[model samples]
Structures are given as structure tokens and as C-alpha cells.
Target chain A: MAAQLKGARVALEVDNVTKRFGGLTALDHVSFKVYEGEILGLIGPNGAGKTTMFNVITGVYKPEEGRVIYYGEDITGLKPHVIARKGIARTHQVVKPFNELTVLENAMIGALFGTRHGQITEEEARSIAMEILEFVGLAEKAEEPAKVLNIQEKKRLELARALAEEPRLLLLDEVLAGLNPTEVAHMLDLLRKIRREKGVTMIMIEHVMHAVMNLADRIVVLHFGRKLAEGTPEEVARNPEVIAAYLGDPELALKFVRRLGGV
Target chain B: MNDTIRKLYTRPSALIAWGLVLIFVVVGVLFKAGLVSLNTATIAMDLMVNIGLALSLAIIMSYAGYVSFGHAVFYGLGGFLTGYIVYNAVQTAYTANPQNFNLTFGRALGWWLEGAVLGALASAALAGTVGAAVLRLRGAFFAIATIGLDYAVLYLVKLYHNPLSGSADIPVTQLGAIEGFFYKTYVLVTVFFIVTVIVAYLARVSKFGYGLSAIREDEDAAEVLGVDTTRYKVYAFILSAVLTSLWGSITVWRQNSFGVDIMFSLRESVHMIAMNVIGGLGSFLGPTLGGMVYYALYRATLTKLANSQFIVVGIIVILFISLLPEGLVGLVKLVRPKLRKYID
Candidate 1:
């Protein structure tokens, strides 16, 4: 698995990115690389800079130090819309749907202004949005206002909106945080299908251990705004530092390692 | 291009806009035929001005969700700039040969048109520069910043004195030298009203409009989703400013004078906002209808209650806000859900 990842082209590279808010460092010199067509799981304890990392990469918060490279081009400190137009798209952890707009309209906004914006007409964008809604299983609710969607449905809508951008790299922030086991399994399957069909590289920030472990091609564990461990799920699951920082129990860590090895 | 035209024609908002312009055209024809009284024609022109102002305000307020409490600054700029240019031109022509100077109808109209064009350009320049700074502030801060913009421009004009007017007040009354000056201005105002409605309709249904609504809903989310929030806001502001300024130019013609105290009145901004709120906050039809309804209510109550006419308008605005926040458009949507898509 490691050898195959090495052979693949690098899709995104974060080099020594440091982000500080006032005197507090949210992401302290964090560095990581995501390979093409892979789902890289970003897992960490609460306040371990996961969402901050997403913000930095998406251009919401400019990092105090270091650069973000996407397909060999430096994109650090560019405006969010500029980054988005460069084929990078993301979903927020707390779902931010255009509440008053119809679900279809919400998705249509992504295509209307996203990566291929102005290249496609409104009619073309409508069809693309519809196709994405269908893919995310929100086709039936397309005409309904996005505010009416339940949490699980809103998550799907978020995913659908991001996918409508036709991004080369997709970042998903805590998409499975509030879902039940069945919904998680469903979302995991959809994510797999997205990668398989669209061949888009994805970086997922997930706290759901089982889903992340089962779905991610590799795992990077963070602790207190620093990288604690980086390896295959099985390797990360067995690492002492990752277990100490994340699970905090040898027995629980051992059980997770067994579950990963068994899978 | 053909499909886009077809879509624009079928749009309910566009239809509403065209309908309003058609009503004004019919009124103009009636006046031309001598079937309507001059007083009624004048009233219809005033109605057009009211609606035109609301529609201009709607571009930024309703569509872009930026409440400009100082929008009257542009209106004042339009009036004063036009006043300045017209006054200077007439003065120059008069001074060149005082006894023989005769301001013809065509010459007077040409001067006013020149002033309107220049005023619009100035308003655009102001909005483009000021919007870049103030639009960065959102919500109530943005609203407050605009009020500051209003005061800053008002004071700047005052401190500079009337370099063009050659006095504190500009007397465009000399333009009354032309026969039927009011009638010509009424015609100009009507044409501009139609232009404003077309602009408001186009801004609502375009890709630009979608980006604006997205920004209104969630600025950060909009930015992240690839809407250039700053550029769109500034564009909308400039459009709003230019239209309002043109109205201001015509206003100087209608009033026959320009006074600093009256031209930049904060009440004008408040009235525009009240009209928008009563019509429906973001719908294209709302402001157009709101302006008419508000004017009717004001006219009806003014004759009976006199000074309390504003009290009546105030009560209606409150009722609309409390009972139907979506205004007249919301009521229509509730009555016919199927018409919702067609309406906006």
C-alpha cells in the first residue's frame, strides 16, 4: 500500500504550514502530502487543528508561515473564490446551506460560480446540479428548500454541492460527525463511488473512527496541533504515540488495531 | 443567446417590470391625447419617480442584502451635479451676451442630459471607490458606514461651496424660460423609470444576481463556493448609485431648484427603505408595487389626516413587518404557491 502511494503523483502538498490566532497556534508547522485519487483521512482530538487546517487550505484563514501546493502550483494566501476556481472545493463541518434557496438552486450555485463558472450556461449548470443531486440521493428533494433538510440529508446536500463544483481535489470537513451507523455506511459507500467514478482526490476530516479507518487509503493523526502519526490505518492504529494521543488506552488501541488488521 | 432572450421574456419578474413600464406608457399616451388632466399626468410622473427610486435601492438592498442608509448621497450628487452643470452652462451662455441669450427647449434638454450623464459617471466613481472600503463591513456595521458616507459627501459639498452655482442654492428656474419644461422633464423621468425597471429585472435573473443572492445568504460560504463577493457587491452598488443619481438630476428639473439642506435629506433614504420593506425584501416585483402602494397610501391619507399622513405610512410599514415580513410578494406567494417561481 505504501509502495503504491509512493508511485502515484502527489495531488496536494502542505509544507510546514503554521497558523496562529492571536498568541495561540492552531496549526503548528503541520506538513502532509495527499496522493492522487486517494481519500486521505485527517483525524485528531477536538481542538487539534483539523478544521483550522481545512480553513487554511481553503483560503479562509491565511497561514502565518509556509505554503500550500496543489499539483505543483503554489496557492497559499489566494482568495477563497480564486482557489475554488482553481478546482479546489470543500464542505463545511457545520453545514452552511443557502437556507431559503431550493435544494436544486443550492447545488446550482456551485456550478454557476464554481470551477467551470461562466464556461457553462445556467441550463447546463442546472443539469449538472441535477446529476450531482441524483448522485448524492437528494434528487427527490431537489425542489424543497434546503433549510427543511434533516441533518443526514443536509450532509448529503453539502457533499452534493461540493461535487457540483467539479473539483480536482475535494475537502470534506466532519461529514460523518452527526450521522448514525447506517447513514455513515451509506456516506462511506457514496464517497467510494465518488472516487471510483469521478477519480477526484479527497481529504476528509472525520472523527468517526470506524468509518475513517474503513474508508481512508491512509490516516494522519494529529495531537495538539502537531502530527502525531502518519501511516496506513493498521500502522497508525498500532502506533504507541497515536494511541496515547487519540484513544488514550492501550486495550482500546489494541482492539482497534485488531479490527483494522482483520479488515 | 436566443434561449437567454426567451428565458428573459418568460420570466415573471421581467413581465412585472414590463407591465409597470407599459402602465407609464399608457399614461403618457393619455396625456398626449389630452384625455388626462395635466395634474393627473404630473401625479403619474411622480409615481414613476417613486418606483424608480425603490427599484434602484432594490439592486443593492434587496438583491445584494446591503442596507444602504446613505443612498440619498448619490441622489443628492445627481441633483447637485446636474444643478451645477446646468447653472454654469446657462450662466456662461447668458454672460456671453446677456440681452440676446435665449435658452431653447432643445438646448435646455441637452444641458440637462449632459448633467445627468456626468452625474451618473461621478456616482459610479464614488460607489466603486467607497464600496471597496465600506462593503468589507457587513450587517449593521455596513449600514452605519453608509450613513457616514452620506454625511461625508454632504459636508464635502458644503465646504467646497457652489463653485458652479455661484451661490449656496442653484436656481434651475431659468430653465422654465422654455415652454412646457415640466412636461419634457416628465417624459424624461418616465423613460428613465423604464430603464431602471429593466436594469432591476436583469440584475435579479442573471448569473450575477445568483452570485449576489448567494452572498446575501452566506458571505463566507459564497466566497468559498467561488463568488467574488467584493466585486459583485461593488458592481451592484455602482449600478444602484448611477440610477439613483440620474433620478436626482431629473429631480432638480422637477423642483426647479437645488438646496443642500433638502437634497441630501436622510428621510429620503428611510423612505426608500420603507418602500422596499413594504413591497417584499428581495423580490423584483416587491419594490415596484411597494412604491405605488406606499404613494397611494400617502396621497390618500395626506388629504384627510394632513400632517399625520406619515403616521399612517408608519403604521402600515409596521403591520407589514410584523404580519408579513415578506411584504406584498409573500402574500401573493401564500395565495398561489404555483406562481412563486413565475413571480421571481
Candidate 2:
């Protein structure tokens, strides 16, 4: 994973972006480039503007300053669906499934929309949806109502839906949240497979440290609505500022860094 | 050949829906042909009209997931407009021969049919214009807005005291034999009901219908998934209004009178909601089943309590909402899970 997609062309770029919600600034002058086919981990403490950054990239929020460039095309202030149709897919932190519909139908919606084949017929969408569900190991549960699925299954359903779009860039928001240890390990393995086999560029926001450190080739840390640090996961784990962002006390920051295997 | 036909049976709900439609048409035709009593035909016509009305309202509400409390606005508008058109035709006859009392009942069906068409068109146009604005609000807000709209139309029509205007509430002249009137109305409403079923099923199985269901589930999420939620909703509203208006046109044609009170009454709207709710919201057979039960209630007891009839309707709807929120169809599916595929 580290050797592959090294020095690849930029798939997505956020240059000098700032987002403000009335009195509070959610993201200020945040900039990063996600290389094509690379797993980019975005780690931050609570209220560190991590999800807000995902919203901006996914077109749910338009930055007050700076532009979002995808493959050299400047896409600023476009509607979320428009951006989605241009091959960007995202999962919500809280999984949302169409409760009345079957899992297949839920996935079929993603395949039918938010992609180049936005005008495809329902039959065409079904084939694509089934293929995605099969890949996500949810083919057996295709006929069941989405609401019948538990939380972990719902999370996988969300991933399958996002995958159904066959997005060029996938924004995964806390895919590992609330999972048991085995579920987390299973998800981490799936992420590795997604990177290796699917080759979809990913930007994952996760509080689960090992999952991010294991899956991401490079990690970016956000703190107080700004890009605090950026490097390989090993380098980021050793950064004093990144440690301080995690734990405010300077002494605690040093202890945390040492615990992370920093000298 | 069998595979081709089997392909059409993809949704069991649609197949069952068409089956029910065929049964109604056959029974309706048999009655018209005197194979059954006139009493049966009248009951069938009433059921067909209510089914059409409930299906239209429920389909829109189900897809959009909003209860339209003022559905009778379209029904009333369609009825009054058709009545006015039919009245104008009779007035011309009276002017030509003041002594004869407009005996153009044979020609009157044509004029009535024309009026029905225009009435449906007018109602749908209103929905398009109003839905664009009112449909923006969701849930209770949309319901309240539609109620306000129904009353506003009613009051505005009431202000017109001119005999030529819609507010005058003119009693339509008798045209042709009573049998002819019954046949024309029965056939006319039957055609509309058939068209309503076709449209409802098409909307359910098509890509557009899928978009609507997505919107019903979660509007914001649907938008993120690339659904043009606003456009789908407005189109559903327009289609629903057009179908309901056709039934309204049939209502005035049967009653032989039109007024704001009779046509645009809030009580009428409440009845429509009750029928749809009792049947099932969003289910293919829900509206049909609901309309039948509702008309049956009218025949069984509501007719006795004419003034306070809505109290019974109110109670029945409340009971259904509490005990069987998905209505009869939902209960059926729960009892026989194997039948869920064919019915739900």
C-alpha cells in the first residue's frame, strides 16, 4: 500500500479553503492533496472540523474562500448531487438506509444515481447493485429490509452503497466507529482489500488509531479548524504538535508520543 | 412468450392491482348490461369513484410521505368547473327554445365529457402552480398549507353571487333518461379509474418512482444520492391532482348540482384522507381496499348519522392509525409473509 500509488497525480485538491458557520469558523485555510489510489487518513479530536472538511469536499458545504479542484477541474459551490454525479461518494457518520426498501434496492439507488450512468434503467442498476453487494459480502441479505440489519451490517451496507456508485473518490467517515474488536479488525481488512483490489482513492476519518495507522499510507491531522500536521502515519504519530492536539498538556503530549513509539 | 409475460409480473403488487381493476371493470360492465341490479351498479360506481380519489391522494402522499389534508380542493374544483361547463351548454339550449327545457340530453353527454376534461386540466394546473410553492414545506406544514389553500378557494368562490359564476351553486338540468346518465357517468369514472391504476403502478415501478421512495425515506440523503427530489415531488403532486379532479368532475355530474359547500368542503377532504389512511399509504392495493371499506361504512352507518358522520370516520381512522398504521395490506403481509411479495 505504501509503495503503490506513490507520487501519483493529485486526484483531489483543496487549496486555501476556509469554512465559517456564523460565529465559528469550522475550517480555516485548510489545504491538502489526495494522490490517486492512496488511502489518506484524516485524524482529529472531537470538534476538530474533520467531518466539516468531509462536508466541504463532498459539496454539502461550500468554502468561503479557495476552490476544490478534482483532476484539475475547479468545482466550487456545486450542489452535493452534482458533485456526487461527477464520481464522488460519501458515507454519513450515522448510517442512513431506506428502511422500507430492501438492501438491494437501497444499493440500486446509489448505482442509478451519483455516477455517469445517472439515466440508467432500474434493471441496469439492479445488476450493478447486486455486483456491489456481492463484493461487500451482503449478497445473501439483498432481499431483506434495510431496517432489519444491525449497526455493523448497516455500516457495511453504507459502504456497499457508496461502492455501488463506483466513485472515483470515496470519502469514508468513521467506517470503524462503534464496532467490536473483531468487527474493527474485519473492517480494517476490508479497507486493505478496498485499497489493493478496488483501487478507489479514499479519505477516511477515524478515531480508531490502529485502523487509520494500518490502512493509511499518509495521515493528516486537523486541530482547531486548521491543518495541524501532515506526514506518513509514523511521522505524524511522532509530531509534538499532533500529540499536543490530542492531549493539551505538554507533559501528557510527550507521554502520548512515547506511547505511540516516538523517541 | 411466457418469459416475456413473466417479465411484466416483476412486481406482484402491480399484477394484483391490475387484477383488481379488471374485476371492477367486469362487474361494472355486467351491471351496466343488466346482468346485475341497478342497485349494484350504483354501488359499484360509488366505489370506483372513491377508489380513484383515494388512490390519487395516497400515491402522492405515500411517495412524498406527506399527508395532504386538503385533497378535496381538487375534487371540489373539478366538480364545480364541470358543472359550470355543463350548465352553460343547457343555458344555450334554453335560449334557443324556452318552452322545451333543454332536452339535448343526448348531446349533453358530449358537453359534460368536455367539461370533465377541462376540469381535470384546471385542477392539475392549479397543483403545478401551487405545489411548486407549498410542496416546499414538509410533513405538518404542507398539510396545513393545503388546508389553507382549500379554504381560500372555497371562500373566494363563495364571494361570487353571480348566477353565471362558480359560487352560484346552480342545479344542473335533467338531461336524457336516468339510465343514460348512469351509464355515461359509470363508464366515464371507470375509464378514469383504469387510467389512475395504470399511472400509479407505472410511477411505483419506474425509475421515477424509485426516486420518490428515496425522497420519502430521507430528503436530504436522497439529494446527496443525486435524486432531483424537488422535481419528482412536483410531478407526483400534479399527477395526483389531475386524477382526483377527474373523480370530482364525475361527482358533480352524478349529484346534478355544484356549490362551494358541496364541492370544496373540508369535510370532503377529511373523507378522502380517511379512505387513504384506512386502505394503506404507499401500498398499491391500499387505496382500493381503503375506498371500498370507506364507502361500505357510508352505506352501513354514516348515512344514518349524516351530520355527525365524520365522527365515525374520525374514530375509524384513529383506530387504524394506532393499531394498524400500515392498514389492511400491512396486516395481510404480516399474517402471511409468503404473500408479501405478491401484495406489498
Candidate 3:
């Protein structure tokens, strides 16, 4: 089913991206492409540089070697806000909702200044913020302080905030990491709905194979900042390299096999 | 209407608090008009300076999340500049002869205003320049850097005192007889109070204000949300310094004197922090309310005990930190929901 969508145009292209921190090479010659209107899954174990890849793509950390070309423009070392203004926004692994602000106000911030356009009127921003909150199923808690939100709600708030920016490309960083089984299912449905209804391209970093295998059109596997495999979710799942890279852990491989049950 | 009033009082108790402030002002005016010889009028005026100082600290500590123990650097510099201006004006008048030592408010208004404005500008420049370097360091490093800067300024001023201009404690008996001098000081305080309110209001409503609050809450989150945390933090520091400098100029004018010890004292910085903490960090009216209460307590009871005031203040601060971390404004907020419950 996922292989049928392989012809989608490239939305983001990373060519030979490398990042070094002090004496350690965090990312080494990483390369991949995210297709337009498709859910791309980026996966790796702890310290495999999955988050660093997201950081590099979102302009948080500049890659020492290589270019991040977004929609045919080289956005190699732009600031985060500039990147956001250029139609890319991201959420943190640890949800970073502005605790002091109400949920509505937090979303309103994204609506007000996400793009480099003229100042938005207060009423318009409020309406848009409220609409985003409603879309994310947080309208009832619009006026509530963000600090009081539970973990799932906080993650949802982060998503709502990113969505409020009206980004062409939305990056989800471990958003489903801490969610329970039912919550994870709901989030997967929400992601699918967002992609279907909003026509927004997404890049999600996940450790959960089942969710990623179910949602992602393509999977890019990373190990120690280097791309190990890139293909359709089924191709990556069946790759011998991915299985060996999971430390030949039969339980993990079995989980991936079960997730791809009939695929 | 009930909710409206409740919300108004919740954030901006200053509006209601001003009613009590106005009544006090009226009573003070009456006292000045010969109803009483209350020497404590000066104390009340000094409290306004404290308010300005506390507001400055609140912006730095509460809004920007940069705890500065070196705000006195700007305050002391403002005082010194103000004193230098007055000294120069008096010298020019003395050189012309006629033995007119009496510096009337009207005669000195131009130079006085110039001095106050220049003092604030210079302090802001200093803060911006130093903040560019110091604000790069966070937490305790930032605090210590500011303290070190304060001491450096104090030492330099101490070594460079002017003999012809007289000592810092020079009696202002000559200026005392000048009509409207005290009135000018009062007006300056009023201006500062208005400025503080306006700044606090902007901090509550503006995009930059939200950026500051976001930074305070979570810097990394704010950055990812498209807020330029470094730029906003620098702006906050500079603005806070400028306000503190203006208050410092007013303090010098009110006392008609300045000295290394008085200007550079860490006690002033600590008092400013205490006022902000005890008022309510990040709340709009927290610092002002805290300043008024702190001043009232100091004037009414603690100051009479001289050195023991420090002990009393320490205890009060400890009590606030331990019992009510949100300070007076926080305490009011805690009581408010209960009050609403009762009313409902």
C-alpha cells in the first residue's frame, strides 16, 4: 500500500549532511529525501542521531558538511524562526508548551508571527488559534493554563502550535514516545487525518515500529548519524541490515514482522 | 461584570491600589500644607524610588529570567551623573559672583532634566554593552558578573572624587530654601511611576512581552517557537537598566547628595530583588505592591531599629520564600479563588 505512493515529488532534499560536536561526529554524510504530501518515517535507536537529523533539517544545528535543500532552495544554516517562516515547523521530544501562557495564547503566538508576513490582527490570530485548538480537540481547554495539561495533551498542544504556523512541512520528533497504546492509536489516526485533510507533508521520528510502519509511506533508517537504509516501509522492514542493526534482537524483529502482518 | 472586576483586580490590582495611593497623596499634601510637620514625607517619596528599582529588577528577574545583583551599578552611576550636573551648575553660578548659592528649581530645570535624561541614556548604553557580554552567561554566573561590574564602578568613582565639588554628604541647606525643589522631586517620582506602569503594561500585552515570558518559561521552546531569545533578553536588560537609572537620578535629586557607599551599595540591589520576589514574580502589579508594602514596613517599624532592619527584612524575605513563593500578589491570587467560591 505504501509503495504505491513512491512517485510523490521530493519536498525536502538533504545531500551529504554531516554534523560534528567537539571531537565526536554526530552526523556523518547523511542523505535522504522527503516526498511531498507523504509521511516519511525517520527511525533509529538511542544515540543513532535521529533527533540530530531532525535538528539539522529544522535549522537548529548546522551540518558541517552538506546542504539542506527545501523545495529547490538551499536552506543550509538558516535560523529556526527563518526556517519556520519558510514553511517548516517542528515539535520537541519533550513537549515545550509555554507553561505560563494559556493553551489559546500559546497557539496564538504561532498564528501571530510564524511567517515573515505583516502583523496579524488580534481577532484574526485569536480565531485562527481557537480553530487550531478545536481541530486538535483542545477547544474545551482553550482558556486553561498549559502547565496543567497532561503529557498527551501537552504533545497535542505542541502539534496544534506547529499546525497553527500553517507550515508546508511539519516535523514530529518523538511525539508518540510517551503515549499509551490507546493514545498512540488516536495520535496515528490524527496524523493520518492531518495528512489527508490538510495536504501537509510530515517527517516523524519514532522508536515505535508498529505506528511508523502503519503510517509512513517511506522509512529512512539511521545508525550513528549515517543513513543505513532508505526505501518503502516494507523494504526497510525486510532489509537484513535493519535486522542486524537492531542487534539481531529477535523480539524487536518479531515486533516489526507482526506490525507488517499482511503488508 | 463580576468576572470582569475579578479579572481586572487579579492582574492589575494597581488600579484599585492607586485609590489608596491617591488618598495617601492627598493626606501628604495636607500634611505639607501645615496640618503636620511629618518629616516622614521624604520617606514616602523615597518609596517611589524603591518602586522604580523593584520594577526594574522584576523585569530582569521575573520576565527575562536573568537575576541581576548589579542593578546598583546603573543606579549609582545615575546618581553620580546627576550630582556632577548639579555640581557644575552651582560652580557656574558661583563663578558669576553675587553670592547667589540658592539654586532655584526653575533656574536648574534645564540642567536637571538634561542630567536625568543623560544619566538614563548612559546607564542604558552601559547595560547594553555589558549585557551583550554578561547575558551570555546564565544563572549564577550572570548574577556574579553584574555584582562584579557594580563593585568596579564603585571603586572607580571612589578614586575619582572631586574635591572642589565637595563631598557626597554636602548639606543641601542652600537648595532647601529654593521654592518647588521638593515639588519637582515629587513630580519626577510621579513620572517614574507612570513609566513603570506603562512598561509593565507593555510587557503584559506585546509580542516581545510574550517572547520574554516564553523565554522565562522555557528558552529552548521559545527559540523553536520563532522567538529570538537572545535579542529579547538584551532588550529587557537594557530597558530595565534605563528605568533603574531614571529612579537613581530621582533619588539623588531628592536627597541632594550622592556617595560611593550609598550609590554602589549591594543592599539596594538586594532590596530591589526582595521587593520583586515579595510582590510576585512575572505578575504585572507584583513589584509595585511589594515595593509599597516593603517600604511601609521599613518606615513604620524596621528602620527605627537601624541595623536590626536587616535582620527583620531577612526574616520577612525568608517567610515569603518559604510560605508564599508567589509573594503578596501570589497570596492575593490564592485567596481570590476562595473569595470567589464564597461569593458564588
List candidate 2 segments past 4 Å from native: A1-7, A116-119, A247-263, B1-10, B97-106, B164-167, B175-179
The interface RMSD for candidate 2 is: 3.6
Please write out the lDDT profile of model 3 over residues A114-148, one tens digit for every residue. Answer: 76324566567779899999888899988777988
- Docking quality tier of candidate 2? medium
Model 1: what TM-score? 0.96
Q: On a 0 to 100 scale, what is the lDDT of residue A46 in model 1? A: 97
Give candidate 3's TM-score.
Answer: 0.91
Off by over 4 Å in 3: A1-9, A116-118, A247-263, B1-14, B17-43, B100-102, B164-173, B337-344
- Winner by DockQ between candidate 3 and candidate 1: 1
- Lowest summed lDDT over 10 consecutive residues: which window, candidate 3 chain B? B335-344
lDDT of 1 by residue, B12-42 (tens): 6777677777887888888888898888988
DockQ of 1: 0.75
Query: What C-alpha lDDT values do all the predictions have?
Result: 0.88, 0.80, 0.78
Off by over 4 Å in 1: A257-263, B1-4, B162-167
Best by lDDT: 1
Q: State which candidate, 1 or 3, has the greater TM-score.
A: 1
